[model samples]
Target chain A: MRAAGRRAPALLVLVSVLLIAADHWITLTPLRAFGSGVYGSLENVTSSVTRWASDARRLETVERENARLRAEVLTGRRPTAAVAGAAAAYQVVSAHAIGFGGDQTVTLDVGTGSGVARDMTVLNGDGLVGRVVQAGPSTATVLLATAPSSSVGARLETSREVGLVTGVPDRGLLRLSLLNADAAVRVGDRVVTLGSENMRPFVPDVPVGSVVAVEGTSGALTRTALVRPFAHFSTLDLVTVVVGPGRPGDGAPQ
Target chain B: MRDPARKPAGNPAGRALLAVALVLLAPVAQVSVVNGLGLPGGGPDLVLIGVVTLGMVLRPMAATVVGFAAGLAADIAPPADHSIGRHALVLCLIGYLCALVPADSSAGQRTAAALGGTLGGALLDAALAGVLGDESWTSVLGGLPGSLAWTVAGGTLVAVALVSLLPRRRRFGGPASRAAARGHYTGGHHA
Candidate 1:
C-alpha cells in the first residue's frame, strides 16, 4: 500500500517485459525443455492414473496384438489396410497423446529419444492429426492442423489440382485456397497433402479431409473451400509420428 | 499483518510452500486433465483463477511474485507455443490489483473484484497475443464471449470459498472498516 508495496509489483512487471523481449530474439528452447521435463513427467503420472492400464506402453502393445488377432480371426486379411498401407511407406514411431493445449496443440509421449523431431508428420487411423513443432528429450509438441497458424500444401484426391490448406480455427475447419482461378472445386471432393520434398512435415496422399463447402462464386480470384478433417480432434488417443522414409528390406509387400 | 490463525505451524514457510504447489500443479492439471475434458464454453483458465484466489490472501508483493511464477508455468507448459512472459505480465498486474483490495473488504466486494480480475486477465492475454501478432488471436477473439462467461463463473466459486475460509489480515484497518466487514460478511472469516 506504500512505496515498498507498489515497487515490488512494478519490478516484477519489468522483469516480465524483459523476458518477453528476450523470447522474441531467441528460441528459448532450454526453458521450454525444462518445462517439458518437469511438467510433462507430471502429466504422464496423472494421465496414467486417470486412464486404463492399457494406456501403458507394455499393455498397449499387448492390446494392439490382441486387436490384430481378433481382426484376423473375424475378417481374414488386415482390417486396417488403409492405415497399414499408408504407414508402411514410412518408418514411424507410435506415441500416445498425453496432453492438450489451449493453442490447438497436443503433447505426444514420443520425442527426440524416439527420433521424433520438429516438422515431422503425425497421423492416426482416420487421417492427418498434426505436425511436430517442438521436441524435448522424452516428449514432443504437435501443432494441430486446426490451429490458426497451420498451413499445409494439399491437392485434390481425384483431379490432382494443387492448393494450400490453412486452419480456420473459428469454424473448426480448414480453408483450402486453390491456385487456379477457375479450379473445379465441389462439395465432397477429397483433399490430401502435397507432401514436402523428402516429406519433412507431410507425406503425399495422406487424406486431409473432404470439401464441405466452396467459398466465393464461380470465377473471380483464387477459389477456396472449407474442409472437414477426418480425425476427431476431441478424442485423440493414439497416433504415429513419421520419422523417415522406409529403409531397405522394408519395401512394399509383393 | 499475517493472521496468526491462518499461519499454522511454520508461518511464512507454509504459505510459500502452498504458493509453489499452486504454481506447479495448476498448469500441469490444466494441460493434462482440464483441457482434455471437452468442457462446454471452453472452461476456465485454472491457473488464472488460482492467481486471483491466492491474491486475496497474500500481501501485494508476495501475490505479485506468485502470480508471475504461475503465469510463467502456464506459458511454458508443453504444447503452448505463445511467447514466454506474456501471461506473466497479465497475471502479475492482476495479482497486484486484487491484493490492493484490502482483506477487510465485504464478501460482495471480494467476489466482484475476483471475477473482475479473471475477466480482465483473460482480456489482457488476448489483447497481448493480438498485439504480439500471434496468429491464433483472431480465433481466440471469436471464442472470447463464451470463455469470458465460463471463466467468471469458475472464478466465483474459488473466490467465495477462499474468502470465506481464510482469516482476513485486518491489523491495519480501522474499527469502522471492521464493523463494515462484520456487517457485510456473516461467514465469520476473522479466524
Candidate 2:
C-alpha cells in the first residue's frame, strides 16, 4: 500500500500532463462528445431544479426574476420592432443558457440536434450574445462577446464606419477600433456588427453596443471607443441562434 | 485524546461514493448554479473546494485520482473551451497536496492547507491558461483578485465545516461514522 501510494500521485500527474498535450495537439472529439452527452443532461436537470426551487416561493426577489422572465417571454412571443425586423430575415431557434464558465462562455441547452451549428450567431432581445464555438450532441458552447479572446467585426449603426471590436474582459465592455483613422465617433453612437460574407458568424445590423467612451486621438492609426453591450451577460437566460436565412414567410414573423 | 478501539482507516464504500459524487455533482452545480448567480468576484470555485475537502479525507493517492477525475469533468463540461486537461493537472496536484496534510494536524493546519491548495490551484489554472495561449496574462491578472478572494472564502468555509464534522462523527460512532467509513479513512486528528 505504501509503495502504491508513493507512485500514484506521480503517475497521475504525468497522465494529466499527457492529457493536456494530447488535447492541444489533437481535437478529442469523442471524449468531448461523451462529456457533453453526460454532463449536458445533468446541467439541464440542475437548472430545472434551481428554477423550480426559486419558483416554489415567489417572493420579493423572486418577483424581479419573474419580471425579468416576463420581459423575456414578451420578447420571445413578440419580437420588438428592431428584433422583429431582424427576426424576419433569419431562421432562428430558441435556447436556454444552461451553464456559464469563467472563460467567458456559456452552454446553451440546444445544439446540432436543434440546428445550432458552430459559427452560428446567438442573440437575445437586447443584442448579440455571441457565436457558437462548439456544438455537442445536445448542447452548444458559446464564446461570449465579453471573453478576453473574443473579437468581432463591427461598424457604426449610423455612419457605417467599419471597425473591429475586441473584448475588454476586465470591465465587461468591448473596444471598437474603426478602420479609417479619420472616421468620426461619438460617445452615444450605436455600434452594430459589420458581419461576414456568408453571415455565418454575424449578421449585418445586429446591434452590438453603444459607444460609451471614445479613446485615443484623431491622428491615431485608427479611432477606438469603449462600447457597452446591449445584452446583459450577467443575467442571460433565453437566447436564440440563427440557423439560416428566413424564407420571407416563416411562421415566427407573423 | 486517542481512541484505541477506532479503526484508523474509514469505510471504503462511503469514501468511494463521496468521491464519485464530488466528481459528478460539483461541476454541474458550479456551472449551473454558482456561475449563474452572477455573484461579485466571479463567485467561488466549488469544484476546487470539493477537491480540497475530499483530499483531506482520502489517502494521498486516492485524493489525486479523485481530483483528476473531478477536474476533467469541470474541463469538458459543455462550456469549457480552455485546454482540455488544464483543470485536471491543477486539481490532481491540489488533491495530492491536501491529502498529505498529516492526520495528526490541528484544525488550523488543515484549514491553512485547504486555503493554500485552493489558491495554488486557481493560480496554477490561470498560469496554465497564459502558458498555453488560452488567455492573456493581463486578463487573468485583472480577474484574479475577485476570484481569489471568493475562492479562499469558499475553501475556508468548506474546510471548517468538514473539519468540525469529521471529529464529531468519529467520536459519536466508531467504524460506522458516515464520514470515516471510507475504505482507508484515517482517524488520528482531533478537531
- The per-model DockQ list reads 0.49, 0.45
**Model 1 complex DockQ against the native:** 0.49
lDDT of 1 by residue, A54-82 (tens): 45876877799888878786876775555
CAPRI class of candidate 1: medium
How far is B128's C-alpha from truth in model 1 (Å)?
0.5
Report the Cα RMSD per candidate.
Answer: 5.5, 5.8
Q: What's the distance in Å from true for residue A226, model 2?
A: 0.6
Error of 2 at A221 (Å): 1.1
Residue B188 of model 2, lDDT score: 33
Model 2 per-residue lDDT tens digits across residues A1-254: 44566588788788888988999899888878887899988998888777778765646676886787689787776445566567667989999899998889999998777877889888888998899999999999999998878889999999999999999966889999999988989999998888887888888788889999999799898899999999999999889898888786565422
Give the residue spans of candidate 2 off by over 4 A: A52-80, A248-254, B1-10, B169-191
